[model samples]
Target: MVFWITLDPLSDLSRPPGDLSSGDLLNQVLYVALYCLTMAKLIDLGWRGARPLLHPAYLLLLAWFAVSAVLGVNPGTSVRRLVLCAMVMSIVGVLPILPRTQRDLELWLGTAAMIVVVLCYLAVLLVPALSVHQADAPREAGLAGDWRGIYDHKSTAGPMMIVFLFIGAFLAGQGRHLFGGVLFVLSLVFLLFTGTKQPTALMPVILLVSRLALRTRSRLLFLALCLGALALYNLMTVGSAVIPSVSDIVAKLISDPTFTNRTGIWNFAIDRFLERPLTGYGFMGFWSTDAVLQSDPLGQLAWTAEATDSHNSYLDLALTTGFPGLCLALWVVVLMPLLDFMRARLDPTKRGLALLFFRIWLFCIFVAALETVFFLRDSAVWVSFLIAIFGLRYLACYPVRP
Candidate 1:
């Protein structure tokens, strides 16, 4: 459902959002049906052990989203987006239990992710206009000729390929040599053409940390490191804009330390967030709404007003959902997921599955520091992150039955 909705929902890629109106409605119906099935299956399975979805974190976040929606700038837009988010979250609630065992999980993930890869590759080959970014794109015009491959932008496609790349690795470990080799090579080749530097660079970092995590007795240190890395990155990019001193320090290192003008957007976001640090502009309100997007900031960066997001999920959350919501998000997204990975790693048999989810969870959280990824409306990375969190939570508590 995720692959189909993200990749094949639109008939016309040129103007996808409007063209996907009917498709979105259809997908929503499908979501409702699948959600029912997932709930029924959970009931049939005794619902006790399969209680990953019942975590307080998820509930609290949902409640916060609801509250933010009501108090947000555009209540109507917030409500619509919140409904869609609920449907997606509900459907993914049962993904961890869908597979009977670890082997079956590998098979399902391999086949599904490969199908997405093949469709992306075929689009790039047959309809370059649709699959690849053109020189004339409205945003990120410099990204022309990069491969987006049935996605709205190369940024989205790059992370999806990385997810597939790991599925390929898992398949290889499971003795599906031919499938694994082809999937890995193809995913790697496609990822390179996307020209997304962060994902490409972070892959190795995630792998290295995962290796350390498995061998070490403490996952807490690694968690601290993760937080540290994000902190340093924020300090470099947005922090520079917030403090003149930080910008002075970063300027000594890089010629354009603003990370291609991301700090300008961050600065504007920070200014607004300070105005209403408690309640925020509301869900889907800060950046996407017409009032905010069209409004002119006379002394601020003009481009920042027209920007899509704060370019930092942490800051974006604070801007839209307030500081408390952001803190709740940190608990839900960052801490518990890693702790789940740590617990799941105790069993040697569950090692591979645990690591897979660990890697996926790790990548998303790190990526979140740079990108606006938390609840970004069915984004591929956001969907995969939820899947990883659920997978780890389930694995930590229950065994994969043969």
Candidate 2:
């Protein structure tokens, strides 16, 4: 888990002894190591221990992705992505069988968070060239300086810090006050250095809402309130004219009149999504295809030509796998865990895991609006999300004492 979370082999600062090709070779080796370890652990669990792994929603989602990949515009690439997804999910499948108690879970979470925080600080202080983004590459408007802090990009580092911040809070709630407080402060410092505006602005609100939702009468009511709030926000922001003051405030906070030029990318992606409404371009298929690069469908848009993704997970999923894919994702990734957490809420012994899953689910859902995290291979956010979903399923199948 630490190996995957740290992504050591993929880090620019930790390149292989030789050239770029050797680095790719090392990455492949590490991936194999990850896959073998996951499978071996699953085998050790035996059929009885692994029975919970047969989650209906998870299986159905993987099946749908398989079929979509088979019929996708880029079958080879889609299949590769599907395999990687399965590998990550396989590792996640072990979560339930591990962690015998809430303390066990907390220990793991705190350890991982500390490791990340320490590594980030080390990179910033000791290896500035690799940790920070250089001026050679064009940056977002208003981002005079940005630090990635051991991550490949500021965008990646910022979201990661946001996640660790929550993890730190979780530790504090678990009674590890000193460790949690230190992690919280460190994560905030790294987030500020990254200069990631939207996430920094949204983190406090997300944490507050998650805490409030946990106190609701039932999961159904919580879900309803969440959906209602989301709808209200959407209605208000659908057009600046609907609520000019609110929109203006948001724009100024992010300091990006065009959302860091995301609007143009979203528009182009939506147009492409319309082109293949059913079983869209395929998983990670739209951006790299020869046809797309040759035709330049986005025209002279400044950001679109150089962009690698839609920037919005929902739109990216829809563009890659269409509405059906999007529906499956929301069901398996979001709604299923939510439902499971709700069911677990009925059991006093299961409430801890339930709350943990709920908080992680809320964070993922919120971040997806601004980042491409859905099913993204090897992303810390996506991996953390899988942990939440799989952890919820684990508790549902094998109820644990709080």
Candidate 3:
């Protein structure tokens, strides 16, 4: 988590190095070594926590990814991205088994989260230019004064602090009340200053919904709540583009109905998606590509051709891997995580840990509505969500006591 977070700070992002992948030799080597160590540990544990890796949904998702790699518009890029993603998945797969008990799990994760929090604060205090966005910065100058806090963007920092809030809550509920409370307060204070309104607004509500989800114990109800949030958010943002009435309503409701010019991007992406709906351009292949940017030129109002992603994860998946890939992703990453959480919660002793992961999963999944996060190439947000995914799976598959 720390590696991903600190790997690409906002300062480095302002002046990105050429050939991002080739220059990332250190990351490649570290991932390989960690992958080997985890595999060895899995073997020592008699391959514990390996069942979910072989699930039919996960297998089909892999198969579809292979299909995308072979048939994608850019086969070379797809293959490289596929390999990197597999390495991350392998590490995520074995992580849950390392902790023998719930307390051990909390300690390891809490310590890492606290480290992240401390480093973020230090960046803010000692290197304000890097930690806080500048008004005169070449890019997104309008976002001046926002606290990114060691992250690439304020949006990224805000959601991550929200995840840490849940982690703190988990620790407190588990008997480390003083430490956990401190973590919670620190994260909350940091989040308030992130200058990203969406996550800040979702903070208290997420806490309430998560507690209610645990109390209700209805998987269907949980899905209803998540899908409802997605629809409301989409309706206000991109849905306005699909319906004239929605556009008019949104225009009346907000100062900028275009949602910072996202509607044009969404429309352009939709048109492209319609062209090759079955199989997308390729995994992470649609945007920022020479062929794509040069061909099917977007209109003036459209998002910059240099845009890294479509700003919507589900759309990015469909744009890259096709509609089939998106469906598989929904089943594999979305639905399956929900199922794991539901089953895991039934184990009374593991409920607290399970709830913590579930809460994180919900937030990431919801936030992805407006962000390209699901498989965005080793992003800290993606890593955090995967940890929640596998963590819940482990709790459901194995009964552990604190």
lDDT of 3 by residue, 86-119 (tens): 8888887788788877778899889989989888
- Name the best candidate (by TM-score): 3
What overall lDDT goes with each candidate model? Answer: 0.78, 0.71, 0.80
In the range 1-402, model 2's lDDT, one tens digit per residue, is 553345642245333223211124555566678779867876776657767668686788788788778777877777777787787778766765766677888888878878987888887788776777665444432443588776777777888888788888777877889998999899998898898876787787787887777678766688886766655543333333235676686677555545655666666777778888888887776665543654474566654445667777877888888888888988887677877776777787777557767677777776777678888767777887887788777777776745
lDDT at position 80, candidate 2: 75
Model 3 misplaced stretches (Cα beyond 4 Å) = 16-23, 217-219, 297-303
> Which lDDT tens digits does candidate 1 get at residues 1-402?
463338342233345234221236675676677678878887887777567678899899889978987898877777777787787776676777877777787888888888988988888899888778776555556877888887877778898899888878878877899999899999999999999988998888888877888877855686667667767877877789888999999999887787777887787788888987987878767674555644453534456444678888899999888888898988888888878887889998788888888888888877776788888767888899888888888888887774
Q: What TM-score would you give candidate 3 relative to the actual structure?
A: 0.93
Q: What is the TM-score of each candidate against the true structure?
A: 0.91, 0.87, 0.93
Model 1, position 324: C-alpha lDDT score: 80
Worst 10 residues of 2 by lDDT: 14-23
